[model samples]
Target: MQRKIRFNKAPLLGDDLIYVEQAIKSGLTFGDGTLTREVESILQDQFDDAAGILLTSSCTHALEIIAILLDLNKDDEIIVPSFTFCSTASAFMMQGAKIIFADSEIPTMNIDPQSIENLITPNTKAIVVVHYGGLGCKMEKIMNIAKENNLIVIEDNAHGFFGSMNQKQLGSFGDFSTLSFHGTKNISCGEGGALIVNNDRFLDRARVVREKGTNRFNFKSGKIKKYEWIDLGSSYLMSEISAGILKKQLLNSNKIQMGRKIIWMRYLNALSEWAEENDITLPSKPHNYTHAYHAFHMIFPSFETTKSFLKYMEDLGIEAISHYVPLHNAPIVLQTEKRTKELNLCPNSSIYSDRLVRLPLYYGLELSSVDYVIEKVLSFVVEKQKSKF
Candidate 1:
């Protein structure tokens, strides 16, 4: 009998269980407990000694906090990659933003800086970029674009945690960054995230925004007599239970990160030849990048080949799946967004989104299992030639 391989497994390779038990016993399972602050501190130190860090319920919520902080409205436009999770655009949309979707770079599938520059207008207030698959985007270019236009840069860094470009951390480049501790992420706490505020001016407001429009953080720091609702916000706080788990995950980062890196390299090394012969494109390993080792994906020659390859993996009891569909092409966006004036704004986004497939990658995934997956992946045939979606 063959063993089943999962696309991703929620990690438990450390003392997270112990911390969870302690948090429950302490009767402080609410958000902002001691354990939660510790997680925030860990992230702050690791991500460029960030000025303000707030643990949130999810990366999506963290983005929402920034959206509220910016006071976005219909008069303001925000540029985001079409190839990203919906929250990247929807968060700002909830704040009445005009979502301007941009194309992706072929090298890394991150938002293309040129596309971003072209999309910017007088009304463009922010540029949101996702570091797809833990690989850093062209942040230097993106940051320069933002600087030139005086637009805020928000990094939806759910996939890039410790990953870096030019030896600086991925989540540290933007004016504001958000991290995901989703079960599928490299360092997970079942369901948690953090907001990393790099700009000093927004540091105070970010805390209030995360605390449901209240100045509670000020009150806690003895800067105020009482906390009250002062701005647009929500209960975007992460629970102590999740933070307890996250604390241990952070503490065990060395072992976990190393293990995942080894596995990711195994796939890269073994699949190189097979991928070349099959006309499949592996994830880019640029000289300047330290990958977060989030997920290993392949870009097949065509959507048909991608579909067939996924089914082949499924038949072998090895789970593989496709990633985000182009956000501009998503049903909700197509139905609600008014983009008749500028058609096919993100062509590259549609091309890659339809032709990509992601394999399993997680901490403690056995080398032998990884080898088996490599072998099975090598056996798939790519009869279909590259074609339009």
Candidate 2:
């Protein structure tokens, strides 16, 4: 019997056992342990120009801290792509800021720089850019707009660890960048995240915020006699056990990345012609951008066609699924006055929500498994065409 291929799978080596055993022996199972420090150090080293790095419980928490550091007011507005996870906009919304949903470029599924500039107003405080599927956004254009407007740039790089554009890393482009290490992500520690502060001024505040408003981090470093609450914050730190697992994953990142890339390329090569002949659209790779192969998605002709294809694939024991719904249209958006029609955001996002399907591509997934998935998908397309007769 063969194992069924999953849409996304985590690569956890036996090294996690060693780390857990070491953490148990050290007796520092909480957040402020050597393992946590090591994980932060690894992040700093990888993101070289970062002023500092703070580990958080999840990317959502990292985004929340960024909201605090931004000091958003009730009247402030933050522009975001509509085709993203809720955390991208919810973080700012939580700070009482208005969310201005921006349209995404059809080809890359990233925030359109032109639309971003058009949406800027006197009350605009920041622009949140999500590097969708580990593909870098149009940073140069977006950064130039932000600089001209004197607005902060926050990067939602949850899917883009180790992804780069024009030789510069993705996380370094903005004032702050957030990463996720959830089980479903390219990297995993069960549930963890990190904040990369590019500007030195935000580092101290970020540290205090992550440490539950205490100066404990400074106190532990001998910079202060004792730690105490100095500002509004929360407990966003990751446990030592989680950090220990992440350390091992970081060490083996190259192997994991390589395997994922091979799988991604295999799918592209195998399905290119079929995709073209069927009038389906594959993902676009922008110039100067290197993707981490976080996901492999394609657009079908229509929502009905996509649904039909998914059912056909499922019948064949191949589980292909769709990506996010347009957040601007989600019910949660109605709670706030930020109406979906106001921004004229991404008509394409609605199209993607209805028509796109994501296929499986995980590290350590066997070549035979890849072929099986492709075969099933191609067969579905052929059978669906025949059934239309």
Residue 249 of model 1, lDDT score: 86
lDDT of 2 by residue, 1-389 (tens): 54456787789666566786789899889896898888889888889899989889999999999999988899999999999999999989998999988888876788989889899999999999998888899999999999999999999999888899998999999999999999998889899999999999999999999999999989999999989999989999999889888889988899999998998888888898999999888877766788968888888988888988888776666668898888877788866664555554568787777888889877788889999998877776788668789
lDDT (0 to 1) per candidate = 0.87, 0.87
User: Could you tell me the C-alpha RMSD of candidate 1 in Å?
Assistant: 3.0
Model 2 local distance difference test score? 0.87
Candidate 2 lands at a TM-score of 0.96
Q: Score residue 105 of candidate 2 by CA lDDT.
A: 83
Clashes of each: 0, 0
Best by TM-score: 2
Model 1 residue runs over 4 Å out of place are 338-342, 382-389
Q: For residues 59-116, what per-residue lDDT tens digits would candidate 1 score against the true structure? A: 9999999998898778899999999999999999999998989999885899989899
- In model 2, the runs with Cα more than 4 Å from the true position are 1-3, 338-345
